[model samples]
Target: MFRNIKTYREGALIEDEQIKSYVESFESELLRGISTLSALSIIQRHPDEGIYGYQLLKELEQETGRTLIIEEGTLYPILRKLERDELVVSERKDSGGRPRKYYKLTTKGTELYQHMVGFFSKLLEAITPLMDIEIKLPEKKFIYCPNCTNKIPQEAEVRFCNICGLNIEGLSK
Candidate 1:
């Protein structure tokens, strides 16, 4: 199957003729199987209320600067899988008299999401020097767990990484 060139905006993914296909394929491959994480991220944002499909799509695009786009056709299946796996729970709500299904992360999901964010952040930070891009992490607000690299709020006064159960009390010293 061939991806239509017209679908991609000029100079966006198709920046240079020599590396355009490689670049396009690289991002597509890199982003494969990331929908779960993306959906979790969006749902985590609406912590108290949760979010709907359309809103998740919009926020995914906006938050990623449109670099990652998940079509509705694909999103529902991923959401269903997440639900089946117990990562998210769905609730039906009446908003303005219209019923809609909203998704919220389960406790297990929340823990997993935190670990994923930490892992991804560490991945980026590790590759920054090679990419020649500096990513300034907010150490004052959060610290990466030395054991599993899970992100922990600096102010939380936790003795362990919530995700990995790694002893972190001494890190405060």
Candidate 2:
């Protein structure tokens, strides 16, 4: 027989079922955006020799210190979507006795990855000032627009953001 669920007014302890549901909801919401970007990055890394679904999943886990936990069943649909979007392409190859589908980024995908890198870099930079801990990017000789985070070469003398049209002359001073 199943136990009857009790309310707080009844002074019953919170059930394991309730806690599990809450955790699952929270994790799913948090990973919604991140999972797609992570998958794309994994595919991007194996450009010369494309990687299959299982291998891609393993590499993602290893690269993220096991923090980006994506389910095996969930990865394929994402791959299919990427292929449909023309961001990646896949080919089936005979490996030993089984046909494995390998995925690699297209030219468009590479461009997208670069754009995403800039976006995330700028996003983090904008928020780091408010955080208690300081986060720094690896030493690079590039400058980013404070308004739009558009990266410019250290040697460029541009006074405005090409993307957002924000005047950046003040930052140089």
Candidate 3:
């Protein structure tokens, strides 16, 4: 049916069945308030300075409006794992009256962060257009005749409209 051929909504080109399935199969795959990639990005942005377990929990809560509930128990274990992997380092620091262990990214962590930045950047660039966040601009073209309805190649400066005999007007516009 022509009705089922194509539809546009919210700047997205999606099939009706695809949208129906998405609604029917909605899943909350995002755990820990954000994805692992987002978690690494947060640490990378705040590198150099060490973050205490509780501080990290609070920061995550504040940034995500408590959507990510990072308890110290869950966070400390992750930090320890990172430390063991040599991606991060931790030290007990005394601040006035109390001593707290603080963690910061090590050199290896910095390198990993750089690699992740590039990887995610490329991934986002590729996926953003599909997600409707960005759209690729159409190339300019001049139609040689008005009746032509065929698509012109990217490198072609002029095209002939198959439908009408008149030159397509304002195609490049």
Write model 1 residue lDDT over 1-173, tens digit each, in one string: 12334476666646666587776677666665576788889999987899989889999988987767876678898899989999899999987788989999999888888888888888889999998999987767778888788888888878878887988885754
Candidate 3 local lDDT, 73-131, one digit each (tens)? 66666777778888778889997589988777887776555444444444555689688
lDDT score of residue 135 within candidate 3: 35
After TM-score superposition, the amount by which residue 52's alpha carbon in candidate 1 deviates from its true location, in angstroms, is 0.7
Best by TM-score: 1
In model 3, state the lDDT of residue 108: 73
- Model 1: lowest-lDDT 10 consecutive positions: 1-10
Worst 10-residue lDDT window for candidate 2 reads 1-10
- lDDT winner among the candidates? 1
Q: Is candidate 1 or candidate 2 better by lDDT?
A: 1
User: 2 or 3: which has the higher TM-score?
Assistant: 2
TM-score of each: 0.81, 0.70, 0.50
Instruction: For residues 37-85, write the lDDT of model 2, one tens digit per residue.
Output: 8898899888888989999889988898777878779889988998999
Error of 2 at 5 (Å): 24
Off by over 4 Å in 2: 1-20, 139-173
